[model samples]
Target: MRIINNKFNIKMISENFGRYKYNEVDKYIELGGFIGLKVALEKGKQHVIDELKISGLRGRGGAAFPTWQKWEGGIRELDEETFVICNADEGEPDTFKDRELIAKDPYKVIEGLTISGYMRSAKTGAIYLREEYTYMKHELETVLELSREKGYLGKNILGTGFDFDIKVFSGVGAYICGEGSALIESMEGKAGKPRLKPPRIGSKGYLQMPTQFNNVESLAVVATILKMGASEYAKYGYGDSIGTKLISICGNVNKPGVYEIPFGLTLREIIENVAGGIENNKKVKFLQLGGVSGPLAPESLLDTRYTYEDLWDLDLGIGSGAILVADEDMSVIEYIKLANNFFHHESCGKCIPCREGVHVYKKK
Candidate 1:
């Protein structure tokens, strides 16, 4: 999704979206594409991790886990066959942010994964793309090919003697595959269902090799942070949040699209200023923050800052950074019905509450 020009702070990963086309390697190079990896290499390995630690970058795929911790864990795993994976299966109902990152700045993701590969000492990287986004697969593959030819993805990258390569793994159209374990299981030719942790992704991820699996946005932002430096990149967000966030705003909004707002913006500011206010000037009654699993934020919470720490106090999350706004005319029951129907379909019959609870709501 090419960002429609708006007077908002869409920095870092999204600065080049509509300004330039990312179809060619030359365009990417001219616009400073692989500089992050170059700077990362120059900063030395430990400092690279240190910068991530200082950046306060968190996982963007709903998990809200700190990016630096994941990187540190991956680095700690001393397996030669470790791998880095990008979860490109953007299946969240209101979340389509990852697709933009993949479609527009494919090379950025490549550079991010390459940097991740170096950090984790992993020689292989994979992007688990959604089946519906097959259109972008070819474009991303083309970028990767050109990157390899230009000494970005192959052996002896930039003559650093570090070898890493990336491949796109087409998904099987299962929402559960968004889970890291399920994704790995599907990749291994098995049913895509959540597996027990303990043998976590870092220890026994893809093919039992230590893996650092990050969402597309998370890894792409890693590339951006590498270039901007921790302190400079930390300038945008609210107290302790510290970064920009790509929020996919939909439903009852006048200009519904992805808007990259700095973290900690009130829901009102985003819905009013960023999304051009609610559609038809209708008063927003409630919001579905994140996707179905996220909180049902009432209008009273519109003033609430968008942050994991703040939202968690109210039992909410920044799941994929998606906000679905509903006007006063929208029925609350209908929303529940839709949520129940979706969860009913997605329930893998793993637990009683989720398995039977959705069904009960559907019957109501």
Candidate 2:
């Protein structure tokens, strides 16, 4: 599964991407697309759970929370009809990994969501697509129909009594909808805003039912773990960062594109080897590991690697793997101003603190 990268070789998740053409279900079958769902059917739910627990895969949308831990809480604790949701809003400024995944291999997301649905014993699944991606709705709908026809989705999938179906909920152009609870709200025909949690999303989400939602990348990896097995996937990453991550590198790079690389690669290595170094041979002043919310890493820490354990030690959150590199000439003040501007516009105005804080900062 060699990737078509402009620069250096990336040793990660792009292997099976673009293998099939335009929802060609037969090609998907031949190339082993829904085999993960097939494997999931054979392995059973507990096996699915245990395998992910061992694989150490986490939510790739940014939080980097363990996959197993999330499922364990919902699957083990509650006894109610659950729903599986996929947060495809992809509202982050620099993030494009989800878009690429869906655009290239829409089936992978379907297969992953289907597997997740079966695992949760869910009867329904929904992908909350961002409003900007409304154009993809027809294509996605076509893909869903194809999946159902191929027996990957719909009632009694693959001759198993695991009845489930999916829908695409094209949401408003609100960045806040990227949050699971907020997405759930949007799905429920309410204003898309983050919910206050004591009864967290897993306990009471999406119509006040037990809901399990994952971002596009995390669910896709569920399919990977089922097919390749946990230990095999675990072999890629070092220590706690035990799997490949889909990184979308933009801004001031020689070759800018998404690359799926294993954990433990330093920021320097990624910018140099993976991305072919800075754009136009200009010196980089800093790198923003995640999007606007992610910490600003100085050029001195270019050696810093992107591992959950290592990043946690630095008190940095990997909020969806969108890396932006800036040259030495870029002013930090201008960066701050731009960030404030985005925050100002995207504040949602649901909360006074968030709204007023940005407004005050702009005034000051």
Candidate 3:
């Protein structure tokens, strides 16, 4: 009973498709879920990293950096304490998929981070979730505890002599903390703000360790790609950018939730099929392709594919994989003003441009 045009039924990492319903473990066992981890335990470490390089998977977060490249940075670094940080802060107003993933399929996220921790021989890993997602934090903590008990986390994972542990850290509600450096800082018990480069997170993060930070979606996909050979995962998306993306459809969509679609799918198709189109069949006047940081695209360009290259052509970004739609009758200026107010209120006063700019807008 699969939709012909949409491949939503296909499971990404497991036969479970990250289902966290009651009795998920028995369901995963019935459908052969977590087999990748089992196979990975048998194959050893290098094979795992090799599978990821061939996936052609770029990060789904706003910055579509190649996942393999990010992993390589930590893998090749000459450091004893390499780390992985799952960015689940989800501060973007238009973003919700991270929270959804955390709440619905926390084990999958943990699985991804666990796999990543194994790949880099990470001493420690953490999921930086926002304090607002209190329920999600609780859910993930339980999953982590379960994983540790199953010998899939903590020392000697899967009896393979791998020692890695994961912690769930809470962010105190700053959008800037969604950035990797700020996330690391907040994890270190400092104010959430960005820092200058040279001694970046990968080089010195989370107590001055070589760190790699990836969004919740990116890490989840990495786990899937690592499990299923890279070539198989690359089959879904279009051209050079391979694999699917989970987009958060909100504002005027009918069936709004986290919809996983291939990269080359058209915006119209996403709106019509994935999101169930606009409310009352109203014409979409403008679309916010990414999060608030992105520019609005005119409706005339709605047919464009939601690929990274296509987005760059429109002078827009796929920030946080957020799709915020606006109706024909809605006022764009007023919407911008509202968004501006949020930025103003959240500014932490450490940076000049963001701090002063947000203050100026607030005064207006």
Candidate 4:
């Protein structure tokens, strides 16, 4: 897991970089590992949610949904048995930031989940790890055990009477399972397919109980917001989309690793400057923001800012925080064909539009 540090990089979540080894519970605690959970416990649930609201942090996994609203929705639900799920299903191509976060700082993610569990009064939390990351399951389990021994997890955490514990659930490598409802379905031991939404996951999910799903990055940031205070965390990014985002840059770029960049940086700066420009000095043909499902942009649109408002205005999104650059060597038809092939093979075949529509496009 390579982290690129630059003038544009902000060390909110990645603050543990170079400071501690992975799985070192004591070292993590030295650097304020469970401070956010402590803060959440001390300040109370509403204070935690209020800090998130003031922080202006949105979901880091594609959708820029307000973090506070999701937590609030879970609170409003009357279910006594609710669940907090961290979506570690990094099924999208070229997006590995979540995996990196889990590998490098699993404790931060655990703390985030614990804070969320406290906020939502959830007794159980789960990490929906993608199957490809099965190797990490053991390490994560080890960390969870250590956290429990140290009183960070398990019954009556820190004497706060908040009984919470987390378990890792691995997916069967289905891309469609990345969807919120579909992920819940897979967690429930059913076929991984998107469910029709009338009662949203916030209302009924995961064993037909109120459930709150948050991306790995989104939940991780929750701890940071609580630790640093909302006003402090909100100082980093552009309007509306506050805080830094972890982007996984691949394809034609020279530096093709995960980067923690502040929002509002131009795409041109990201591709040419942060990512070390096109490989072999080749001319860029197009760029894909988010993942394969994201919209493509020609070189002409490279100057656009990477904010949620800016991307949404152009009918694009920062989905999955994947920036795939294609140079002149790759043809537009070839790229579209490759993307269609992925959808065709990975579609859960639950809906006619996605199932049949993807097949038709692949055949074309």
User: Which residue pairs in candidate 1 collide?
Assistant: none
C-alpha TM-score for every candidate:
0.94, 0.93, 0.91, 0.94
Worst 10 residues of 1 by lDDT: 1-10
State the displacement of the C-alpha of residue 348, model 4, in Å, after optimal TM-score superposition: 1.4
Clashes in predicted model 2? 1
Candidate 4: the clashing residue pairs are none
List candidate 1 stretches off by more than 4 Å: 1-7, 356-364
Q: How many residue pairs clash in each candidate?
A: 0, 1, 0, 0
lDDT of 1 by residue, 4-77 (tens): 23326666768768654555888888888888999987877788878888788889998888888878877777
The per-residue C-alpha lDDT of model 4 at residue 315 equals: 91
lDDT of 2 by residue, 33-132 (tens): 7878998898787888899988888898887788888877766744788899988999888888998888888888899999888878889999988999
lDDT of 2: 0.83
Model 4 — which ten-residue stretch has the worst lDDT?
1-10
- Stretches off by above 4 angstroms in model 4 are 1-6, 358-364
Tens digit per residue, CA lDDT, model 4, 121-144 = 889999999999999999999999
Indicate whether candidate 1 or candidate 2 has the larger lDDT.
Answer: 1
Best-performing candidate as measured by TM-score? 4
Candidate 2 lDDT score at position 25: 79
Give the whole-model CA lDDT for all candidates, comma-separated. 0.84, 0.83, 0.77, 0.87
